[model samples]
Target: MNIRKTLATLGISALVGLSAAQAVAAGTIKIGSFLAVTGPAAFLGDPELKTLQMYIDEINTKGGVNGMQLELVHYDTGGKAKEAVGFAKRLIKKDRVDVIVGGSTSGSTLAVIPLVEKDRIPFISLAGSVKIIDPVKKWVFKVPHTDRMAAAKIFEDMKKRGIKRIALISGSGGFGKSGRSQVLALAPEQGIEVVSDESYGAKDTDMTAQLTKIRNTDAQAILCFGFGTGPAIVTKNVRQLGIELPLYQSHGVASKKFIELAGAAAEGVRLPASALLVADKLPASDPQKGLLLAYKQRFESKYGPVSTFGGHAYDGLMITVRAIERAGGTDKAKVRDEIEKTRGFIGTGGIFNMSPTDHLGLDLSAFKMLEIKHGDWTIVE
Candidate 1:
């Protein structure tokens, strides 16, 4: 599948005037977004844009919340933090959007944090990083699982398989660096030992040197941390080197595109992923199964396949609407408080329980230990 062609196009209707605080004058409840729809992380941000647009169109058709039309003003950040910060300022200072849902990458999200906090605009980041919500910025929240959560889930599964010594090969990007820090920091606490640690840049096309160094170690399994094409390159390199060690990847690669990029080499790869990957395989009694299947069916009907990245956008948008309704108006402070009070909300990623101190709000049960089998996700038995 040519995912580039399948991705959603950027949608921006009109630019807001210089007055940033006037949502009413903007003519609707504006939702501003900054995503990486055309960059290296387009695999993630493109689908996210589609999901948000789909939901907004449906919501508007259904009379919208409190008899108000929701307008989306989004820009493509192209995986650049500085660009995202500029977009955040534009959304708040110029567009007069009531809420901002974006910052597709970990680095981009962090770069926009101070801007959002200073402006007092409610920010719901689509990026994956514990740093986004750890100390809890008053106006910031997230819908995806963090790098710390992914690391803990992988280590838990590794221990179950009697794997103790492991090797790490992570991209030098923000996502990889945060994941690497978590894995190394939690290894000793999880009863796992790191035998090797290697790094590669995001633009690096070959990881043969890193794989060779990792293979030389007495590592029982290898964990690769990266997003988009970088990890796929590592997978291909590991296979070409004829390495027998079990290869595991980060949730950043939770899409069919990764399997296609890695081809036959993707088989048997494991990762800690959101339940959306194997939603149909989940027990009917599970709370998130129905929600997951609904999203999958709707998304596949239009886009041909499903991805967790889009699911993150779906959850964030839905959550934003809910907060708007509970707040009873488009007031940014009221919406932020209502969002923080969100509890028992079922999202595509997991059950959300937002508090002032914890914003991401998902537990270990959110991720499943999944393996690639016959080019699809299957629960590792």
Candidate 2:
């Protein structure tokens, strides 16, 4: 998608500014965002922006929240940490946004942690990293499942299949680095041995060298830790090298785009992901099934296929809006407190039960073991 051109056209009416009616409305609640709209991580950030703009317009049509119209002022960070930090500062100081919701990657999210903490703005990150909330930054919260949770989920499945030794091929990006670290730290606890570990740069197109090295190891299975197009390349590389070992990927690639990118090579690939991808297949009684279907239908009808990254944006926006309603207004402190008190919130990601200590508010149950079969996501029982 031409996100740059789309954003340029949207800037006049939707995303970066308010409409004439909104400007003269009873009041306005400013929501600031910074995302990787045009970069290596555009696949993640593009859907997120589409979801936000679509839903925010929907919400505004419903008379906004607490009688005040919502204003979205966002910037494109291009997946850069330094750029994210600068935009975050501008969102807080210059735009004076009530809440900030963006940060499409762990590195970008982490870069602005100190700024959000010091500024005391209610910030909800779409990134997936345990470090974002491990120490419990008062103002920061996240929507996506943490990388640590993804690691534990994958290892749990590996143990179930009795796979003991595994090789790791990971990208050198933020998600890959954090996921690799988590896997290394948790492997021993799960009784799984890391036989060999290989790394690749973000821009690397070929991973045959890494897969060849991993093939020589005594590892029984391979776990790829990376996101974007990197892991997909690894998947294809593994198949090209005739590596018959079972392949596992991190949740960073839990979207249909990965399967499309990897093509037939994605067959038999497994990863941990939210139930959103297989919403139609989920049990009728599942709490998140209905919400997931609704989100998927809405997004697909307006834009294209739904993605897990977009679901993160959906949950983040809804949670923030719900908090605003509960607070009875847009009081930043009150909204943040309400957000912390969020209980039994059925989002596309999972049921969130936020508390003082836990900002992410999700357990391992949020992730489902999904395998690609015939170019589709099939739940692994």
Candidate 3:
């Protein structure tokens, strides 16, 4: 009887040891991302995903954060807010992620914020919306500046160029409406006049009617706003209508794909964007030079080239990983606390200063004016 008891006790001990080993093996930190990889906003999400992958790969190579491998599991939201909410629930409940990243558009990010707050997981949004960080939930953070800041920059530049009368064209989408509202609200304050205001839906391929109306007006410039393929259509229709005035666009259309989509019309178009997008024009003395170069080289080595969307993703992931490392564990609450204290951490975007009051960590100073010249972006004075 004693011998039989001893054998059973030994077996139980061995089973416990095996279970502990399995737990340790499965302790890898999982990060979640929701993007519109297969929808109208794929141009934005695809590069953002690629950049997240590149940063994850690099972090792992240098001994991952707190000795735990960072695993990013992403869902395709297809540019729908409902899809984004569903995906957020899955990431929080099923995947049990330590953190979440990657929201391609403002509407999708806004939809997922509540879930992130409820689950007490830190979310670093890649989308640019002042509202995303404004009412500032403790768990929600953003790496991109708000659309309001970009709109201000556009108007400031217009004022400098002596452009008083402008034509405003925006798609009837979340980003478009937000940008149009901000511009209209701030134009009078900045002494700029909107001679014509036009709107179009995202699916509309032809904008000649809107462009023609603006062309007939005494507007000295055209301000285009949209994230999807609408900007390209507007650019094409403007050229087709022989409207040769200066063209200014929101940073939402700041990507190499925009140039490809707009073709010749893309040339000489100005927009406000994070300095990382125009790295080539920055001198070596610039603070962001080293970081941007490293990111560019690593990204190009992994994925063909870099884009502004990719830079935002890289900044978001890096900030999240840094906070995780500082926390020394994957505890959600601890990570959230550390993220809120992140100050003066230089990123490709700019210095991040995530406080309890402000989660965006960036302001208008984080952006620089850029103009497309000869199929490439150059910093504008």
Regions of candidate 1 where Cα sits further than 4 Å from its true position: 1-27
For model 2 the TM-score comes to 0.90
Q: For each candidate, what TM-score against the reference?
A: 0.89, 0.90, 0.88
- What are the per-residue Cα lDDT tens digits for candidate 2 across 265-367? 9999999999999999998999898899999999999898888899999999999999999999888899999999999999998999999999999999999
- Please state the error at residue 254 of candidate 1 in Å: 1.1
Error of 3 at 120 (Å): 1.7
Candidate 2: stretches off by over 4 Å: 1-26
Model 2: which residue pairs collide?
none
- RMSD, every candidate, angstroms: 8.3, 7.0, 4.6
Determine the backbone clash count of candidate 2. 0
- TM-score sort, best first: 2, 1, 3
Q: Regarding lDDT, does 1 or 2 come out ahead?
A: 2
| Best-performing candidate as measured by lDDT | 2
- Predicted structure with the largest TM-score when compared to the true one: 2
lDDT of 1 by residue, 1-381 (tens): 465544432111123332443656454789999999997889789999999999999999999888898999999999998999899999999978999988788889999999889989999999998988988899999999999999999999999899999999998887889899999999999999999999999889999998998888899999999887899999999999999999999998987789999999999999999999999899889999989999999999998788899999998998999999999999999999999988999999999998888998899988998999898889875
Tens digit per residue, CA lDDT, model 3, 254-340:
777899999998888899988877777788888888898888888888778677778889888888888888999989999889888
